[model samples]
Target chain A: MSILEILSYIGTFILLINTIIYSISFSFKKEAYSFFCVYLLIMLIITLLTTYYNSQKVNNLFLSHYYFLSQFILLSLFYKYVFENKKNKLLINTTLILIIYFLVLQYAMDTTLFQIFNLTEVVVTSLPLIIYSIIFFYQNLNAKVKFIYINIGVFMYLLCSMLLFASGNLMIELDPLINKIVWIVNASLYIVFQILIFIEWRKNYYRKIPKSS
Target chain B: MEKELLQEDSQIIVIILIAIMILLLMAVALVVFFFFSRKKIIATELEKANLAISYQKELLYSTIETQEEERKRIAQDLHDAISAKLNVVSLSTHVLIDGTLDKEEQAQTLQHILSVTTHTLESSRRLAHNLLPPILENFGLQATVEELCDEFMSSKKVFVSYDINYEDSLSKANELHIFRIIQELLNNAVRHGAAEQITLNIQEYDKKLQILFTDNGRGFDIRSIDKKKGIGLKNIESRVDILNGALSYSSELGKGTTFTINITKT
Candidate 1:
């Protein structure tokens, strides 16, 4: 396999392993992390199905819609729990509603767009998550900031990848070599994101759960 | 349709590249902003904690210094009041034992010994009383304060007008703090202010106690009252701190001084 394909496979496998680990560790507490674990489970399943459809030489671009929408909804709820802001909530809800309405309108007007990466979905979904992470940091300037490592991971990954994802239709029309390079950069950033999550778990969430639990 | 889409593709890619650069720069700027602001906040917190620790250390050092000074004063009193007089009585007894005097001389020596011994005994009793007054232990604060006012009027040559309506009985330890506060203020008025007339009023209402003390002395400026130079003031401040009480004082340079204190019944 080429390095690009190999990197993609590695990211998928790591996501699977991390989801399993988090589910098991967080099952006992059933707190904020329980919702996070559910997000992880959904993400892992979607990644596997997308990889499988790609190997079968079939169209799987439609999966990106589910990926983006589920991610936006679950992670929005997660952040809303972490930091309560009515304004942030309103922004997320309004954006999600607007994007869904626009996408449905586009689908009714034309059906051919489903065969390619929808640029509107990529831009609108990732933008709020980016803004939310920044808001989290801004609100906790003088405090002992919590969930910082995870936030940094999300902020970095989403910010750099948003452009690559948004430009998907344009990228397909360009040199295949450049497209592969973009995927390689994305896979590497995903690895960095996972490493940050691991560090957060080790530093803040490591505990000797009892056997009875 | 295909030619038009192809024509727009390269233009869109160029725009995407520029946009990506802008986003990456924003990300870098944000991280730097959070890092520096967090560092500044944590530094200020550490500074505040250090300031509190140093203040506590200074109060503790002054309290120990006051205790040592009190011990030294009591030791000097023992030497001058009791020790010197005993030396004279010892010398007189030795002269009597030598058997070189006639009956009238022996009688005279005995009388001298009797008077000296009595004076020395009284000095020792007064010294012990100064350490912990029996009047305070048995009669409680009110009776003790009344006697203290009479003693200050007669012995220290200060006219003290004392009025009190306090009714709540406190723990002995707590009462001792109140008594010492009164004693220290009275001593400062007599010795430092050279006050001839002092007025003290202690009133209790709804379990809240207030003490108003004023003296017609050559008062120093209250704004210039330095705790370091006056251990007595530090002692009073620390006592009030222990009792969770509030103390305030005002003075005119040559007119007089007034002190007001308030504390809970507890």
Candidate 2:
């Protein structure tokens, strides 16, 4: 394998370890973090499937649809636990259900579109999560913040990656150089995101719930 | 046409890079903002906790100092009032036992001894009363305050009018603190103000008790009252602190002094 391939796979490697560790933590102490644990596990599964399809020389771009769809759904629920405002939670949950239903309907109508990059789908699914992190930031000003690392990571990585993914089809139509540059940047950002997830688990969720005496 | 297409591709790349840079800057700015804000908040919290701790220490020191001062005052009163008078009586009794005088002389000596003994009895009773009034224990705060007012009235110099509208709902410790505060205020009025008319009003309403004490004495400058000299006022402040009460006072030169104390249910 070349250096670039190894670099890209490092993020995937960390993703695997984080999935196992989080699942273990969840079994010990079921908490709001359980939603996030499920999110990592889902991402790891998608990563394995995408790699498998790529090895067989099959079109794996279609999996991006499932990837974005599952990401929005799981993250919406994860932050649902973090948000204290009842109105914000209701809005997130209600919109989440409606958007997923519509996306499924759209896919049912046009199955061929899965192989193509959908900017509208990316924007619709990812934009609300960015807004949720911003709301979390505003809520915790000059106060003790909950899940600090996770909130920061979600806000930063999702924002840049969403922009990258939106421009993915345009880059692919051009030379391979543009695609390489975008994927390298995307891979580097993913490493940072996984590291942030690792820090959050080690710092907060690693300890077992002290049994009541 | 080919050149225009190339230019458009470069423009798109430029736009993407610029967009990524802006988003990256915003994320960094937010994280930095939270970081510095937390540092400032922790520093502020530490400062507040330190101030609270020092304030508590000052109050504790003042309580100990007031206790020492009371013990010294009681010691002086015993030596001057009871001990000195007993010494004089002891010499007179020894003279009577010597049998060195004739009938008239012996009678004069016995008469002198009788007057000194009677005088010592009254002094000791007054000293004991000053230590802790038995009336304060037997009766409640209302009747004891009334008796306290009558004692000041019998002095023939100060006319103290007490209006006590109370239900006696305070703990014994709180009542004692209140009683001491009143005693200190009255002493300050009589000794320092030299006032003839002293008005005291005590009333209780809905978990709150208010005491208004007024004296038409030669009032001093309120600003001139310092912690170093006005130990009586300081002692009153300490008792009020112990009771978790509020005390306010108004006094002007050539006018008078008024002290208002309000205590809540603790």
**Candidate with maximal DockQ:** 2
lDDT score of residue B228 within candidate 2: 49
Residues B55-165 of candidate 1 have per-residue lDDT tens digits of 788878888898898899998999999889999998988999999999999999999999988998999998998888898888888888888898898875889999987
Please give each candidate's TM-score: 0.72, 0.78
Residue-level lDDT for B79 in candidate 1:
92
Pairs in clash, predicted candidate 1? none
Model 1 docking grade: acceptable
- Calculate the i-RMS of every candidate, to one decimal place: 2.7, 2.1
lDDT tens digits, residue span B102-214, model 2: 88988997888788778878888888888788777888789878888888889999999889998779987788788888888888899999999999999998989999999
Candidate 2 lDDT: 0.85
State residue A173's C-alpha deviation in candidate 1, in Å. Answer: 11
Which stretch of 10 consecutive residues in model 2 chain B shows the poorest summed lDDT? Answer: B222-231
Local distance difference test values of all predictions, in order:
0.82, 0.85
Q: Which candidate is the best by lDDT?
A: 2
